[model samples]
Target: MALITKTDLYFTDYSWSAIEPDDPRVTGEPDSTLLNRKEGYEILYFINKLSDIWSLKNKSSATKIERMIRFEVPSNIHSQLTIRIWIHDNWNESRY
Candidate 1:
């Protein structure tokens, strides 16, 4: 007899919140600053997970990232979504 294993992939729906200028999270902050730092942090965390699942490196190419996104997200969501890649000077060293 031999042991066997199975794996499956699942996609979850995501929603973005509307940010107001008067919101305490961004109130009095410069326009150049992050509008939604929490959201940005979550996105970065998700991207890292994708990279791990796809055996990708931290500096993986944009095309590779796109492919991973396409593979993990449903077609309908991907089609209607817009993705932005932010590359900070210290991205590799930053915790978030």
Candidate 2:
């Protein structure tokens, strides 16, 4: 079985994040090969939406969506992660 050392999560609202590089499940680099696929290591994740509301409805002008992500891992170790959120059309790269 191939190991899954990296994980990419995406949301319907166009938000995304990745967990990689120093992920606790990754014991070491995989052997150099055509696919560079790792073995033996695996990571499992349980995704749940903390908030009850998935979409905004009759929200006040003062209210806003926070662009942030927080999660806990079994290893209790810190790893570098990146998250991308779609703020608007102008901010999109394809426009360039």
Best by lDDT: 1
TM-score of each: 0.27, 0.14
TM-score of 1: 0.27
- Tell me the tens digit of each residue's lDDT in model 1 across 1-96: 101111111222333456564554333312233322224323333444334434554443323343344443333332111222332222344332
The sequence of per-residue lDDT tens digits that candidate 2 reaches over residues 12-87 is 2332235464654333422121111112122212111111113223222001212122221212322212111221
lDDT of 2 at 67: 17
The lDDT per prediction is 0.33, 0.22
